[model samples]
Target: MPDVKFKHVVSCSSEDPKNPAANLVAQEAFRKWKGVAGQPSVSVILQLEKSTKVRALDIGNEFSAFIEVLVGKSTDTEDAYH
Candidate 1:
């Protein structure tokens, strides 16, 4: 049997620059991803970026905060989708 595994990493950062709600939104977005997969072996990394003038956060600064969701699937799953 093929040991199929799926993983996804998601990151969120606010575009408002000063809006604290962006951090909250990122957290909620990460939490929401928990339901994306029902398999026990599936793994995910949720990252948040809160930038300050003194200490810059890795999260990017652009117009309209965005949540990036990347989905990874194992080759073993190729048969399942078909």
Candidate 2:
């Protein structure tokens, strides 16, 4: 199966500038997105070139136990993600 590449990072709940959320979508995919230390949970909103249904995902875990993925459309308003 082909990989789903993201168009860009829409909004990130919390991220360490050193390792930005955008790195997760980078073509290289060498870098990882890191949240600021002490945060309980981090959320990220990403845009795709078109609508896509993800059947599988390949991830390299570091210190995380579980991951959640959310899918939605983007509106013109700031609260586009729903």
Number of the top candidate by lDDT?
A: 2
Per-residue lDDT of model 1, residues 1-82, tens digit only: 3212212234322223344332333523432222222332322343223321223223442332344434332433432322
Steric clashes per prediction: 0, 0
lDDT of each: 0.31, 0.78
TM-score of each: 0.19, 0.75
Cα lDDT for residue 8, candidate 2: 92
Error of 1 at 18 (Å): 31
Q: Write the per-residue lDDT of candidate 2 for residues 1-82, one digit (tens) a residue.
A: 8878788987899999888998978889475888898777877887988888888877565577777765667645665443
- Scanning candidate 2 in windows of ten residues, the lowest lDDT window is 73-82
- Taking all chains together, the TM-score of candidate 1 against the true structure is 0.19
Deviation in Å, model 2, residue 82 alpha carbon:
8.0
